[model samples]
Target: MRCLKMLVIAAVLMFGLTSCGVTNHMISNYNVSQTQLVLSKDNFRVIGDVEGRARATYVFGIGGLSRKAVRENAIADMYRNARLTGAQAVNNITTTVKVRSYPFVMEYEFIASGQIIEFTGE
Candidate 1:
């Protein structure tokens, strides 16, 4: 009976932790600014590339920022890091979400990336 009970406990623990390894990936595009401009063929040049990442965790479905807030925070972080000048802008923005699911917790990582460009002419 002792061996049988130990076997049952081990099985239950294994089953419980199985959800810890689950992960999901998602990608989407968003507009960070209201003023949209069409990049001219020869008016702007790529200055560099930038990326911003943010993480939020929730346990038992309660904690941290909401999904929408996390995404916005990631984009805002990217802009804060860029420190764009008067004639500089960020383009080709993409946001990636990494979700790690556990039995009682969820971890989210939001990554925002884009290329910085500077206009050579008006």
Candidate 2:
């Protein structure tokens, strides 16, 4: 009976942890400038730095998580953050992925960061 109770407790704990969904992070200023272009570093003048991240957790490796999905979500978040900074565009974009593993679960985060910029017609 004691063994059965311990097993149940462990199962509940695992379930609780797995059910936790994605986490996100962002840093930006509220006074954003409106613009219609997503530019590269060479095409724009960087005004400030912006960052965004998204995380997804998998239980027993069962969730159909894909890199493309994660990356897209992170990029979307970055764009939103850029808008918050009133950027005309985002430049110098960089992306990274982090994974953590436990006995029966894994958590991964997709992180995207970039510099907010304006057009420099040089």
Best candidate (score: lDDT): 1
* Candidate 2 Cα deviation (angstroms), residue 50: 1.2
**TM-score of candidate 2 against the unseen true structure:** 0.58
| Counted clashes in each candidate structure | 0, 3
> What is the RMSD of candidate 2?
8.7
The digit string of per-residue lDDT tens for model 2 on 1-122 reads 99999999999898766533444444443223334564444656668888777777778877845766877688789888776433267755667777766657778888888877776655
lDDT of all predictions: 0.81, 0.68
**Off by more than 4 A, model 1:** 20-29, 34-40
**Per-residue accuracy of model 1 over 7-109 as CA lDDT, tens digit each:** 9999999988875443444454557464356655577788999988888999999999998899889888999989999888888788888888887888988
Q: TM per model?
A: 0.80, 0.58
